[model samples]
Target: PVNRLDFGTSGLILFAKSAEIQAKLSKEIQEHRIERIYYAVVRGVPAAASGVISLPIANIDGNRRINEGGREAETFYRVIKAWQGYSLLEISLKTGRTHQIRIHLSYIGHPILGDLKYGVKSDFINRPALHAGKLDFQKSEFKIPELAAALPEDMAGLLEALQA
Candidate 1:
C-alpha cells in the first residue's frame, strides 16, 4: 500500500498481482494513468462545488502531518450532493501519500465525519464516513483489460442515508 488511507476514508485501492506488475503500477501512478474515485460525507458543505488541493505531506515523528517541506500532493473534490447539514463529496488523488485525503480535507476546513486526528468527532456517526467508491485502469497484460467493484453494503447504506 502506498500509505495508510486514513482510518475511515475508503475508496479504490490498487494492488499489483506480481512484483513485475508492481513496478509497472508504480510507473502508471507516477504518470497519472490510473483512475481513482472516492466518496464521503463531510461535516460541512464546501464553498465550491469542485476544486483542488495542492499541498505537501509529511509525517511528524510518525504522526501524519501536512508539512510544506514534504512531497507535493494533489486532491480534487466535487460536491456530489448536499443534505440537511452535510454534503456528499467525490474525491480523486493525483499523488498518493499517507492520509492524503483526510489531511487535505482538513487543511481546507472540511474534515471527513468521524475523522479524529484531522476532524472533530461526529454525533451522527461513530466512524469516519468515507469510502473508496471506484477504481478504473487498463490491464493490457490481462485478458480482461478493465474491471470495477461496487461499494460495500454498509457504504451503500451510508449513501442511502445521505440521500435520504
Candidate 2:
C-alpha cells in the first residue's frame, strides 16, 4: 500500500502487501479515485481563508518548477489556524505532481516553514514541515482499508511553538 510521499513529508504512507494490490490501487489513483490530504506549517498567513491553487508544473533541469508547459496541477487548501507570522494549513490534492504542494504554496507567497527550496529560510523546523495527515480510497467491492496518520513529534512541537 505504500504510495510515494515527498522526501520531506512525514505521516501515514500507504503500503500494498502485494504487487497485485499495488497495481489495483495504482489504477485507482490514475483514475482519480484516491484522495491524499496533507497538513503543513507554513510561513506567512494566507490572505484568503481558503482557496485553490491551479497551475501547471514541470521540471527545470533537475528541479520541479511551475511552468506553463508543464502538466496541470490542482491543490485545495484552507487555513486551519494562524499565528504571528505562521499558519497551520489543511491541504488536499486534486492532481499530483512533483512538489505540487510545496511549489504551489510558495507560489502563493506562503512557502512552508522549513522548505528552503520553495520557502524562506527558517530555524523553526528541520524539514519541509509537511505531513501526510489522511488518505481516502473510494472502493465498492471489498474492504480495502482505512488510512490516516497523526502528526509526528516534530510537527506537533512546531504547532505548540506556533500556539505560544
Error of 2 at 100 (Å): 0.8
Each candidate: RMSD to true structure?
A: 2.9, 1.7
Q: So what's the TM-score on candidate 2?
A: 0.91
For model 2, the superposed segments whose C-alpha errors exceed 4 Å read 138-142
RMSD of 2: 1.7
TM-score of each: 0.81, 0.91
Q: Best by lDDT, which number?
A: 2
Among residues 3 or more apart in sequence or in different chains, the pairs in candidate 2 whose N, CA or C atoms overlap within 3 Å are 1-14, 1-15, 1-16, 2-14, 2-15, 2-16
Instruction: Report the number of the highest-TM-score candidate.
Output: 2
Candidate 1 ranges with C-alpha deviation above 4 Å: 1-4, 138-146, 159-164
- Candidate 2: how many backbone clashes? 6
What overall lDDT, based on C-alpha atoms, would model 1 receive against the true structure? Answer: 0.74
> Per-residue lDDT of 55-146 in model 1, one digit per residue for the tens?
99988889777788898999999998887767788888898787888888888888887777886576556777777776546633333344
* Clashing pairs for predicted structure model 1, backbone only: 10-131, 10-132, 11-131, 11-132
